[model samples]
Target: PQVVSARFECPSCGNIINVSQDDTSFKQPTKCGCGRKGKFRLIEKKLIDAQKLVIEEAHELLEGGAQPKKINVYLHTDLTSPLTEKRTNPGTKVLITGIIKELPIMTRSGSQSVLYDLSIVGNYIEPIEEDFTELSIEPQELKEILDLSKDPKLYEKLQLSIAPSIFGHERVKEALVLQIFGGVRKKRDDGVITRGDIHILLIGDPGSGKSQLIKRMSVVAPKARFVSGKGVTGAGITATVVRDEFTQGWALEAGALVLANRGYCMIDELDKMNKEDRDAMHEGLEQQSISISKANIQATLRCETTVLSAANPKFGRFDPYMPISDQIDLPVSLINRFDLIFAIKDLPDKERDKVMSRFILKLHQNVDSSKEVPIETGLIRKYVAYAKQKCFPVLTDEAISEIQNYYVKMRSTGVEEESKSVPISARQLEGILRLAEASARIRLAKTVTVEDARKAIDLMQYWLSELAMDKETGKIDIDKIASGITTSERQKIVGVREIIIELENKLGKVIPTDDIIKEAETRGISATKVEDSIEKLKRSGDIFEPKPGFISRL
Candidate 1:
């Protein structure tokens, strides 16, 4: 409803009058100057399509489990167009100028009640990127942040500041700090772009401080969103497509990831999410964008947000000898998208258990005392926001040399090119570079130094040692995490298949399980491994069981 001038003619004395429709409701001149009391003849009129929407508060603003507040707004005329409607996307912020009015509410008896509802007749609206709140830092605060960064133990202090009550996992805390101050996004002359946001996953035992870290992070970061996998859908994490009856088209609605654009998002209990819901996040995590095409509505929303997710093991506990991928139900493709994956284990140690118990008791007795951190949570939040907004570190020659040396040396560890168990790939190299840049930004430095590169490499090596090690070969293998199948597993499968073929040639199309196990054991493979390999081949349709004790290759 754009403001249009409408003219009405009076039948009495043939008088002409003009009236403007500037208000939400149309109004005609009650009585023309000619003293006419009847309906006036309409000589001109203009109508436009419009729609109403209700916007709710963002997830970062809520404290714990509070319900979000909502407000109603109306879009007029051209504002209802597809392009314009995308600006004021739900889940993001918006600044609007409008006139508020109260409308009567209907009671059970179908009559207007005394109470009324409030709505705004919007005249203008624009998109706004929210950073938790309108956090404005003064000049004095900026100086304090700079001085804090210059401390010799700056890294340790920052790590201790996050989740102070947690006993261990200093490396995980350091990684989270780096995640807050991400790397610089690069755009080349050819229009190709590289994502700077980092994604990390933590899978561990049940009571191993995973959820506690996530909750503390929600308070430590100025613009952090917290979500759980339970009760979440594909549309809830990415974007939802709704059928609009008024426009007879589909409308796009932003979800958790989009709402946290340029910020941090923590997802707890990640393993509990449905397969479809988890698949929807593959594009958002890598490309930094969310695309939805449903009912003829196709669009892409920018989601340059960093993710830190946590999950528990499928069997309720973690085993040191088991492969990380085998213990979790996530797909290999999704696993490869994460820049860093940490495995947190809870083991039994008398001394460590005693100290942890004492810490927990003290926390339960007087929580305030256990909350002591090197820096206050609020100032740390402001410091993170300032570093992300003002600092962008570029790689220096020494830093590049450090990264290159590490990659060249690591890649050379494999045996041969053809079926080599690559220890690392370009994906890991990019992750290390991003981490190095972020480490420099933590100190507000203009260029990444050699020290930053080494620190990032050390952290990456730590994670790899725990999750990416091939237990059978006693060597690091990237395929373990990247493809969920290691060189050792592949070798076992091949050996079992070859043994079956040789047995068929001698035993006439029938292979006995006892003979296969004996041959495998002679080749240094255990009976259990041989049985597992045979089961794997059977499931893959490479072989089948002809009788209870025999298996034949198909």
Candidate 2:
């Protein structure tokens, strides 16, 4: 502690004595040259405010899979004020302007040891606005990034650069590139906030390179934390409330998601997670926040993180007609939180197989050939950081019109109440707008263009065609993917419930299952539909079987 000023009044002779309290121990006026010593009153004392911060090195600065190192920085006076403390939160990147200092370590007897610890006494503190600006870019690198952005084939080059060793996933790669350069976070005048981070899920066959892609992304993205779903508990994914021994109260310990705020968290084998663990992530992915209310502590933590997860379909194979929640062990509620879902199948194609085979063989023959990405890992990270910091794109009138037309067209497909096959929802519209904003950011554009809108629309359409197609009606049914039951199946279930109600009104509490089936069949509903609907009703707790063939409303 550095003392600014101190004053003392002597009781022996009523003389006011002043002394500079610069030492850590309380300094006093030892003598006034009048044979006086000790017992000086500390009437006034002032100390300089100070705070210490631990700063971690950026991931891009490490090479050969090394761990990042951390250093302690000491802030003084105005730097330790409450308003300036926001820039020093757990995951925020900050630049320190200061001088290095060393403190000698004390031994057991309170004697100074030979060893010393280093620290920085900061004169200024500045927070970096971008997500991963800890990887500071040089002037030459900025020039190269600007030139690359101007290239006509920049989009193609960027797509090819993501996971290049994996053959032929141009669409997934393109989406991944946009995910790196995410949309700008916005808050409306009404205090409603919209998240900018993108979350993507990959569901496919076991050997379809899902884990490989996740690992590659983890390597490419700066400050990315990788975790296996089966290995993490619910508290490890979100946060935990535990007793704080020092404070004698409760404290929220942030887990992987909260710790990776404004960064990336790549989860692998998501199907292996427990239901409770998946439930904990739902709020964080959608709302970009995690709330904790336990053990007398209540607070919300910001987790503006982008997530890329990969999971294998159940039974180790991809089935196009099945619902996503049915194919994977994840719940539909959890699956819907992902902005984009891609079902990658491993069907055999002669030419594509031959090329992939050649590519793998050549990689083994010459390891150097595996380095085929257009941009190096460090430069790619810097480029993304630069674009995110400098670019903030707003939707143009033309782009807004394009998005409006697409949303209206998709909404019209599910207009009829009888079908109720909703092709899209408001979530998808918001996702498309975010993707368009990301597309503009990648090119450092100030406004989202019509072409950007079309790119986003095309990607959404691709996802619809792949994962949301209903085999029965041959139309894009979002419910088929969002829920296990299609609209037609739901309608049949409703019809069966109505017939059961009519039978109960006339035939007393116990109605035979066969009588209900016969009534459903008379109304053009199939016997199979009736059976499925009865089982669904029983499972949903609407009706129950009292005996072998008799059903009753609960």
Candidate 3:
């Protein structure tokens, strides 16, 4: 396949001639013009660069439940360079200028069949633009975008335009708006990179419009893939290696995250994913790459994808009394990766219920009663694209100080004498910075001011108060939402363990369950709390039930 030039010597006349092979196969000159029509002596052959590539349709381009199609492409000479090869890698959307030719198919009986397979002999290839940064805007549209950015209530207007049909969730809508207009990703001089993408998770009760919200987000994003957690696999979400039917060799296939690079991936029913499959997202979420090392095929594929996911609680409805980590089936490590986690509860409120009922009734009656979108969808999309393409905001001194002071103040809230629980960490600080950048981008500002910093802090404070703060201690304990265990619960478990130790010393090796519960109650731990702690300890192998109604520490 790489043969570029062939030289042959005529046996009769001893004439040396060179021929260039440009077609799919090597060709020999028919005559040497020496009057001798016999076989020529083989001289020399030169070979150049060549490679085989597999091209497939992108997952995002598929519609109406259609599957992606694939074909083999032949690359030669200039097309086989490193830069061109990288641009044509799997999962990347590319435009190829090539010749479509047919290759003879081999039948099962080992004969060449008349039927042929189509393949592309690529002469030129280029990757398609996958991010809004490459969006093209007209001069008139640019003027309109700049004018819209100057509006005093631009943020509020964008939030209102997100999903007009969904009632309430103003805060969630605001977060989604910021997510759509992402922050500026930066790389430090030391080569460390920080992501600007905001990952949002909606954990709500059944019939709370979570799926509808996800669908709306997918529709609004410039490039997005809508998938359900139940239907997705580890290979489906990341990268996998498959046997190529045409090549009869292993070929790497890009998954959802890789296919949606520089875009958004909306995953509904997030909690329905299996543990092993969910674990595969760890690298893609944090590192923005998926490393596949299966079937002797090892490669890391880029996946700079922002995830917007929705999930239902384990018990079919959210439990307001329990920590969010306890109510969901997802691992605490995985839950912590989300920048913002919102709980959408369906509570019983007389006036709110009446309004919701009326809204649904109006929809059923074919009457338009919903509030009009503050900004049209097309205009907003262009506005967002314009901002993302042209605006890259940097933090001002005042903004940096604001974020720093808030982080210091929140972390210092723990009691000085006790084992201080971390109220907020550097991760949240990074989140705050990203949100502030997004806020500034919304206004098309190149500098993040104190006002933008304040907005970010307010949103962060609201999320912390609702999801991270412990009501009993009146302090924020990240462990409550991050580890599925609160400081108060940890203290109760420690108290129960202490009671068991005391009883074991006072009584024999076996301590009665009633005595342990009575001692824990005296120490201000409720009987039910003590019993729950005991069961947890037993399951963790810290203690064991020696006999009925009796326990012994390991």
TM-score of every candidate relative to the true structure: 0.85, 0.81, 0.87
Q: Give the TM-score of candidate 1.
A: 0.85
Q: Assess each prediction's global lDDT (C-alpha) against the native.
A: 0.84, 0.85, 0.85
Give the per-residue lDDT of model 1 (tens digit) for 136-226: 7889988899899899898888888877888888889999888877788888999887988889999889999998998888778766778
- Which residue pairs come into collision in candidate 1? none
Candidate 1 minimal-lDDT segment of 10 residues: 126-135
For candidate 3, lDDT tens digit of each residue in 371-462? 46778777877787888888999999999999999999888876552746778888889989989999999999999999999988988888
Q: Estimate the Cα RMSD of every predicted model relative to the unseen true structure.
A: 4.5, 4.9, 3.8
What's the CA error at residue 470 for candidate 2, in Å? 2.0
**Is 1 or 2 the stronger prediction by lDDT?**
2
Kindly provide the TM-score of model 2 when superposed on the true structure, using C-alpha atoms: 0.81
